[model samples]
Target: MRLDERIVPYLHMAGLYHLVRLNETWFRSDESLVSAFMERWRPETHMFHMPFGKCTITLQDMAYQLGLPIDGNYVSGCLMDFERYIKGGHPAWMRFEELLGVLPLANCIDKFTVKCSWMQETFGKLPHGVNDATVKRYARAYTMMLLGTQLFGDKFGTCLHIR
Candidate 1:
């Protein structure tokens, strides 16, 4: 199999690769629908108060829509460790440099943020005969890109928090 094909197992293991295909046609945003939803959203009740009745989207709904595995516990990272990644001073940066083979310039890094486009352009393609460690790193870069472009996408949507 090709080297690019190797990353499939890693992404599949993480339950993310399938989401990439959704972007081909299934993924789309409707501003008017979003506005309508927002208009009826009740944060206090955590439900949508419609003229008919109040209802809420369950985890199952999200799982069904996004093809995410709902069986696993909610995964989250510690923000406290973010300070250690600043300015390439910490060992985490060293590990990143080792995996990616290059660090973004100091000017390009905004606190814990880096341009997702820069990351995609930099590590998007893996070198031939790369070791498992290198392939894992590429998988991680793709994961970050997927997250930044899909679920947690912000208005600007240009950069992602690297921490």
Candidate 2:
């Protein structure tokens, strides 16, 4: 299999695990394992989004703060990965479930399964053929979901929020 093909399953599993953690369940048991997996799979680049209140930071504005060219391409790659996985289908889901099982979180199994259901539904509506537009939309949605979930978790005092 191609590298992309091999990685797709891992990505799907990671995505599902992420979704479960974001759903307000504390994966206390699997914390270390999850952390290790995240450290391995997460992008090396730093990502920051402006909070909803009392913050002013645009992607363009952040450039001055970082003193580096803030390329939007990093976000683009995230979305592209999602698109590629969706197009690849079953092997991706299988890999994702397998990875989810590696974590010691008990409740996570069901939560991750549900996340896969949501992803499948959302992906089914997209254009079968991949294109820049579809990828961008997927990326934007993914980013927004992350932001909203984090904010929600903070207000509710749940462990679901991204750290």
Candidate 3:
């Protein structure tokens, strides 16, 4: 709900303004329909055995539906190396705290994980008359939330890796 507009340029620079815009729009979903699909899904084949035929949603379909660009530099890498480096000397949680200016609650987290609600609570509102640095920080946090919740959501559901 906090579309500060100041973050527009930052989001644009990072190639994520379109995704952030989607947050403003209303999207309706049917739980029963989704449950039906889930029931018909064959994870081994990555397809749905519907009554009519086998079907699978392709990346192209998702890209089109989500208004995402199809062509971009292929992103390939692992965070394992970065995590190793971080663990070697730099304290992971300390670094995370330094960057985000907050610590995850112990009861709700394992490893460098924070709840999405915590992110919304912490950075959902921007302070009045803040400087460029603060705006950039907010933009970074917003991008992280978008990626964690929208693009790369996993079994963790509401929790996301802070690293």
Candidate 4:
């Protein structure tokens, strides 16, 4: 199947209506909003929205499209990995914590840290050439966008930098 066909459906599935609407409002080009969202959203979480529903298009699906099995749980695993990555003194974690517009939940942070450590130890194998710093920033920005989308929806306009 075509890449766009595969992804557009997922965007629709992931309940990213706001994101799609944002693309229409902000960027008046025929560009791939899904690609932009993936690049800007949580790059670590290998999931995107379907073009028509609230289901997610996972990296496993993409891998399957490339003739592999959808056997890995990389996306969900990454969430925990991220918690550890943050606990490990990733500068971007500080930035993200600030950007979320909420004071760090001290108790939650501690708990999350332990969970993240377990995830890292379990699925911690690194991908080749994955720069830690770049991943950190991207994860932060993606997280910001995800939260911002939830908080503001389409009501806040361009007050948040989505691009």
**lDDT winner:** 3
RMSD of 3: 3.7
Pick by TM-score: which candidate is best?
A: 3
Query: How do the residues 1-163 of candidate 3 rate in per-residue lDDT, one tens digit apiece?
Result: 3767887899899878888745636554454776677789897999999999999999899788887777877654456654555654677777776666667678757666778877888889889899988888888788878878666654444777765
| Candidate 1, position 94, lDDT | 63
Task: Order candidates by lDDT, high to low.
Answer: 3, 1, 4, 2
Per-residue error (Å), model 2, residue 23: 24
TM-score of 3: 0.70
TM-score winner between 1 and 4, please give it. Answer: 1
What does the lDDT read for residue 5 in candidate 3?
84
Better of 2 and 4 by lDDT: 4
Cα TM-score per model: 0.66, 0.24, 0.70, 0.21
Candidate 4 lowest-lDDT run of ten: 1-10
* Local distance difference test, candidate 2: 0.37
lDDT of each: 0.73, 0.37, 0.74, 0.38
